[model samples]
Target: MEQPYTLEPYQRCGLASLGLAALRAEYPGLSWHTLGGHFRSSQPFWAAIGANVPGGYEQRGVCSHVTSS
Candidate 1:
């Protein structure tokens, strides 16, 4: 999944969180994975959503693992 964007006026209103919640509800067993360096600045966000950045190299980047809740 790509980083979610909201208009400047709508930033930090939990819109992205809400959307992710809905997606989880729809796909209960879904898992999210991405390259570690793809969104280097969003590490906190990924962690907040329960994603784990495991140690080790994945291809050319690190591995990001998001297990289903």
Candidate 2:
């Protein structure tokens, strides 16, 4: 789930939560994983949804991989 931004009038009114909820309902039992730097900003949301971050690697700021499920 990337940043759930909306137009000025629609910001911060639970739209993101509703979208995520719909996705979860559509894809039951599927594992959602996000890579490296995204982990930094999204950690809280992932934790709230019970996601687990197993490990990650960064190679000279060129290549990176982070597994969260």
Candidate 3:
């Protein structure tokens, strides 16, 4: 399948993960803390590398709903 946006493969994955985090925040039973922690622990290198990539650091998940609610 083709995506409407023009993001690269890794960028797509990162956006999808961020979207999942958004949905989880809207609904209960979604654990952003654990997920974020897991991602941090498992993909420390990826995060570091992403930071260096242009516009990579901005591709982060939003979980404000979890905290606001």
CA lDDT scores, all candidates in order: 0.55, 0.50, 0.45
In candidate 3, which residue pairs clash?
Answer: none
1-69: candidate 1 lDDT, tens digit per residue: 654557989866767667777877898767554423546655555555544323321324333454444
Between candidates 2 and 3, the one scoring higher on TM-score is 2
- Please give the range of 10 consecutive residues that has the lowest summed lDDT in model 3: 30-39
> Which residue pairs of candidate 1 clash?
none
By descending TM-score, how would the candidates be arranged? 1, 2, 3
For residues 1-69, write the lDDT of model 3, one tens digit per residue.
122233555663566555544665687463323333334443653455345343433324666665633
Best by lDDT: 1
Model 1 spans > 4 angstroms off: 1-3, 34-36, 51-69
In candidate 1, where is summed lDDT lowest over 10 consecutive residues? 52-61
> Could you tell me the lDDT of residue 65 within candidate 3?
62
**Candidate 2 per-residue lDDT over residues 20-53, each given as its tens digit:** 6676679866545433344465555544433332
TM-score of each: 0.51, 0.43, 0.26
The TM-score of candidate 3 is: 0.26
